[model samples]
Target: MKMMERLETFLVLAECGSFTEAAKKLFCSQPTISHHIQKLEEQFGAPLFIRTGRTAQLTRQGEIFLDYAKQIEQTMLQAGSAIESSMKTESSIVSVYVSQYFANYYFDEILPTLHASDPPYRLEINAYCYEALKQALVDRKTDWAIMPYYPDDDFIRSDFAVHALFEDEFMLVLPPEHVLMNRKTIYARDLQGATVLLPRSPFLIRSLQKEMDRHGLRVQYLQMSNFEVIKQAVKSGLGAAFLPYRAIRKELEAEELTAKRLPFFGYLRQNGVLVRKGARFTAEEQAFFERLRPHFDEGAPAGRSAFS
Candidate 1:
């Protein structure tokens, strides 16, 4: 098989996780998919996948190969699109990366405006978290990344520029019937010896520790990643938790939960727009930034406005 065809087969197999599924995706027989993978394995002189029952997992070499394959695929597609754009005199593709939080909150408002604009162009958006989004920008895999403000890092800050979009504060959340609900403000001392449900991220854990240390208090922590699970845990009276104001606004308004002001500690997080420095932007991306500029300028007047 040709290199491009084999590469396509490998990518489909990786996505679907089985030869049968890959065959279906590629509109070919399972045997053909198997033959392509077998040829690839022979050329590389190593096993690419570890088969267990009906499932297949990528081996170490396969994992490394997959990354390179994706980069090559993206480059080839970009080159082809560049040729097509030159031939037809059309605008180029605009690729952007956004975190899951921002995508859920703001994508709907942004998409419609782009769709109605002149000189129609392609828009590619990748929803990724911290490290993946950072790498995408550093590798020039994405043109822009919409995410929370990360402290300046060598790979990211040197090559990209970030614009502050908006800031939001973390809120002290409690069940409606919790004792803290009656209080106008809650202090770190108020949470001493209490169980605090928090996300299992180093940044958050470290920040919490610093806050607790400042007040000379200690608390038990229930660490988990799923937001819904954390909410449920808190609602069951298992513990108190802190979340971004935007995340719990509906619950607070519905009176399902109550929030109290934090004392002395700001507990703020900023969201920013990250773009590759000196990277050329297509018309669509330029128009997106133009539309986005006003919202950031408006800032957090109420101290808890939703970017959505």
Candidate 2:
């Protein structure tokens, strides 16, 4: 009996030209739809619809009133949008969480491009270590992430939504002066007895370890918490690292860090965007993603995980 409900029902019935179809759209019984239409007709003291055997046609008065109903609907939509925006402002914190290394290495250039948006919003770049980033998404402390892909798990599949951001491949990086850089084609034998720097993500570590064990390789590993640190360490001859090539391209171009042409054994890492399922992205969040979408233009993921 609410004004908007009655108006919406009338609009649906008019558009469908059938009481039965309107009932289905509105998820109500046909009689309920009919009764709603009847009440509106009586209020205006005019036959709004000419019901003829499961179909309805709007009369002249009904046609005239449809304009007013549409205007009301538009107004309601605007009002709802305004209310939602205001509510978001009152709670006022928009943030995208990711690994600190990703925030600096990957998104640093991509994020600054958003500075020209009208009615600017403050998007907090909440950076954390790998384990903390996963927990934050699971706990709903943050909504969106700009990070590498992780295989789906119970919490990820059930509670979070995954978006494949880009197809990335791991590169073995060493100092430019390292002996491995002189090799024409790097192989597993080249990495024998080397100290490999690794990120703290369990999934990546596990996947890499499995591959190493399968390949019958033996190497000393040093676990690092950030990509930048790992890169810097490799550049300083502290150790070598398997990092996403796209992430460390600047270092490659500048000849600061050297990438060995070792076979990764078809292990391609997929970068991804993770948000809590059913979370609404802010305007800035949507725009930031659109700018970065070109990198992820692999069409669709051919594989789910690095090894899978």
Candidate 3:
């Protein structure tokens, strides 16, 4: 048990990259975290981390040990699951991590129906940025992740099972009184001299730059970190933005905002659900996945080859 505690502390410290943050997460003191890490290094016969200022970076040996530590955690989880199944006790709770857009726009409405079914499966959903979403799966913290997929997204490797979902189209969103609101179609060239509000997503920014360059338009950009903030910026008449249709669906319907097709290709944002390739799903988790299937686009065939 002491060794297990040490390994757990090591994993958390690696994940956090800071002993102070790891201590806060584990509800322990910094000295205790240091003690556990020191013991791990002694058992492994090597210094695991190279400590700098306030950060702890894994050495080559530490990187190798991370995989083994994760395997131990996973094995324990499986053993617990097996014991719980034998006892036929508590319901299964599956954890899913998703992007903020999905949480705000889609899942709020979908969760109710999912929770109401017979033999209702317990679900634990956490939302994070795209990078954190991927890390959660790598660390085995979450069972699945849902996020926007891009053509250049190389992270969806062979080790992942991907279900390519719908393409959320990027549209030109405008305030009701904007000059472009009266235009029949919003073309890329038409964006000349227009200030465009943009989210800080690297993929979206790169795509936007490519399209702008293709049209030879030197448009002004106001970069924001939050999607809600981008939407409000457009609504406040600060600038027009290119956002997914689902993101502004309600505003368009209510006439608080106006949306137009981008009048060119390569504006679609693909999305997908991903799980680790060899995961063993309990009956309840499988049922929850089935319930979610009908709600999303029924386009992608099951077990589609990695997101390409």
The per-model lDDT (C-alpha) reads 0.74, 0.76, 0.80
Task: Please report the candidate that would top lDDT against the real structure.
Answer: 3
Spell out the clash pairs found in candidate 1: none
Ranking by TM-score: 3, 2, 1
Off by over 4 Å in 2: 1-93, 118-121, 280-288, 299-308
Give per-residue CA lDDT, model 1, range 54-82, as digits (tens). 55789999999999999999999999998
Residue-level lDDT of model 2, residues 84-172, one tens digit each, is 99988855445667776577676666665555445454667788876788788777777767666667455666766667766667778
Name the lDDT of candidate 2: 0.76
Better of 1 and 3 by TM-score: 3
lDDT tens digits by residue: candidate 3, 138-218: 788865677776666566565676676667878788898888778886676678888988888887788877877787878
Rank order (by lDDT, best first):
3, 2, 1
Winner by TM-score: 3
Where does the lowest 10-residue lDDT sum fall in candidate 3? 299-308
Model 1 weakest lDDT span, ten residues long: 299-308
Candidate 3: which stretches are off by over 4 Å? 1-91, 302-308
Tell me the TM-score of each prediction against the true structure.
Answer: 0.61, 0.61, 0.66
